[model samples]
Target: MMALAVDLALALVAAAAALSFWRLLIGPSAPDRILALDTLYINTIALLILLGLRLDSALYFEAALLIAVIGFVGTLALCKYLLRGDIIE
Candidate 1:
């Protein structure tokens, strides 16, 4: 059934989110933390869109788009800082 498939997808997304959180919390290096954060952001967007699909609405999709953009920007800034010691110079 479609519902069962959707539920399974949701569970997988949640599990990935949890794993991302764990990596973010206890990563062994700066790049590892950054990678975890990046993964978590992407997973969050996926979950949002999945939830929107499950609910048959477009609201969460917009928020997910916003999060996707912002998360990319955030990671870019962090990477810039890691590389150059400043996000704005």
Candidate 2:
């Protein structure tokens, strides 16, 4: 039952990641693309943590945490650039 649950959860995350990828490819606006990338990052992090749980390893969890932090920082930078028209002025 636990394995089945994990499979189901990962399947859902995979679906979310696919949808976000499509959005990133076809989004009309820059912000839309950025948002889609943000969603993809979140899904990736979740998937990594789930895989860690299934494999009984904490390294994947740490990698997921790092990804989350990097993703958040990148998103913030993108949003700032979009809003202010400058990234490092």
Candidate 3:
């Protein structure tokens, strides 16, 4: 059924998010942490989309869009800092 599929998707995405969080916390290097953060954001996006599908709400989609924008900016800043030792050049 559609409901069962949605539930399964949610569970899988949630598990992926948890693993990404673990990597973010325990990463041994800055680049590793950054990569983990990126993965976490991606997983967050997936979770948001799944929630939207389950709830049948447009609000969740908007929130997911906003998070995607912020996550992208944050990742760019982190990468810039890593490359240049400063985000503001």
Candidate 4:
């Protein structure tokens, strides 16, 4: 059933988010932590989209889109910092 599929998807995404959080907390390197943060935000967007599907509403989709954009920009900034030692010159 669709409901069962949605539940499964939600569980998988939640598990991924949890693992990413663990990495973020205890990663051995800065790049690892940054990668974990990026994964976490991506997982969050996935959750939001799954929720929208489950609830049969388009409302959560907008929030998911916003999160995606913000996450992308944040990742870029972090990468820039890692490369240049500063986010802005």
Per-model RMSD to reference: 0.9, 1.0, 0.9, 1.0
Angstrom error of the Cα, residue 27, model 1: value is 0.9
lDDT of candidate 4 over 38-81, digit per residue (tens): 99999999999999999999999899999999999999999899
Per-residue accuracy of model 2 over 1-82 as CA lDDT, tens digit each:
8888888999999999999999999998999999999999999999998998888788997898899999999999999999
Alpha carbon deviation, residue 35, candidate 3 (Å): 0.9
Clashes of each: 0, 0, 0, 0
Query: Which regions of candidate 1 fall more than 4 Å away from where they truly are?
Result: none
Summing lDDT over every window of 10 consecutive residues in candidate 4, give the lowest-scoring window. 61-70
Strongest candidate by TM-score: 1
Off by over 4 Å in 2: none
* Models sorted by lDDT, best on top: 4, 2, 1, 3
Ten residues in sequence with the least summed lDDT for candidate 2: 53-62
Worst 10 residues of 3 by lDDT: 55-64
The TM-score of predicted model 2 comes to: 0.93
lDDT of 3 by residue, 7-83 (tens): 99999999998999899899989989999998998898898988888988878888888889998999999999989
Global local distance difference test of model 2: 0.94
